[model samples]
Target: MATFETEFLFVYGTLMSGVDNQWSLRLWRACGQPSEAKVPGRLYTLGGYPGMKDPLDGEAAWVHGQLAQLPDSPALLADLDAYEGDEFVRLRRTATLRDGRIVPVQVYMYQPEVDENQRIWSGRFTFAQ
Candidate 1:
């Protein structure tokens, strides 16, 4: 029965819940609880964090993560973009929600080519505690 603002985002790495760069929680909190979603892409390890490489080849591969319905805050988006830096580029893409709804969201994609060994075979990436 709660209505949330519609600037959604898909986060799979540090920006995810309970990760190191959780400073983004301020933005996440403004959005409300994140829901599980899947996007077309592959997850790869980039040193200490993970990155998403969108195949753009339809849904052949999928990267699993949470979809956060963020508020339309320019400052917050700018902060996130700056935090992601040049390694990740933000893009708008469709994601399949847990309940089978497909919606467009802002996704930070990894822009570098990675070795096959660096890839996460499960399509899901998380920090090992």
Candidate 2:
């Protein structure tokens, strides 16, 4: 169980498109639409939860992701927690949207103990939603 203080997130894989998802509801509440973006980091297949590291940290490559605007409030945090709350840890990160708009988005990173295998979801992404 944990908490976060932010109004945006950079969803890399499933949360993007073609991946089963129902999380966009809360993310789109703040803005009329969520932007398709890429998070500058590395994507790791950590079981069901994907792990990502920012290029700002000096990684050779940046991961691809979609930027979504979420409500910046406690209840929002709680709801987000309830959604992906347990699977990973929420962290603040800067994401470069597909449009090249830079903004801070929350990224739920998988833990170290998490395995890179056994993740059922396809890493293929799109902003179809």
Candidate 3:
């Protein structure tokens, strides 16, 4: 398993800022502010939420999200891991900020089988209100 070397986390779904979910609120409270960032991947609509996966060959799309600095707390990490459940796995990846600077961040990648038709071409996910 890979260990998280940086305190940054990239969230692309309901966990992104402005979402009213309980975990999103908790994460915002603990991680302070967030900045617009994107990772090289594809976003898909997984029911009410969204999932991210590696981009297809020669694909230049990016999964748009917010990057936040997590506090140094193991309990918080454990809680996030539990919230993600078995359908997602955390991995380290590079995120490109709006200003074009690349950063290392930990992100949850979708693990279950995906239906290609559910792909979100916009790359940015918005939870329906």
Query: Evaluated with TM-score, which candidate comes out highest?
Result: 3
Off by over 4 Å in 3: none
Tens-digit lDDT track of model 3 for 1-129: 346778899999988888898999999999989999999999999988999999989999999999989998888878888899889899999999999999899999999989989999989897761
Lowest-scoring 10 consecutive residues by lDDT in candidate 2?
120-129
lDDT score, candidate 2, position 3 = 49
- Candidate 2, 2-95: lDDT as tens digits: 4445567777765553345565544555444656766555556654555654443554466665666665466755666677655577787777
Worst 10 residues of 3 by lDDT: 1-10
Could you give the C-alpha RMSD of every candidate to the true structure, in order shown?
4.9, 4.8, 1.4
Best by lDDT: 3
RMSD of 1: 4.9
Query: lDDT for each of the candidates?
Result: 0.80, 0.59, 0.91
Candidate 2: lDDT of 64?
64
**Model 1 Cα lDDT, one tens digit per residue, 1-129:** 112244788988878865645555775677778799999888898878899987646558899998888776777777888888998888888999988999988898888778979988788886761
Candidate 3 backbone collisions, by pair: none
Q: Is candidate 1 or candidate 2 better by lDDT?
A: 1
* Candidates ranked by lDDT: 3, 1, 2
Q: List the residue pairs that clash in candidate 1.
A: none
For all predicted structures, in order, the TM-scores are 0.87, 0.63, 0.95
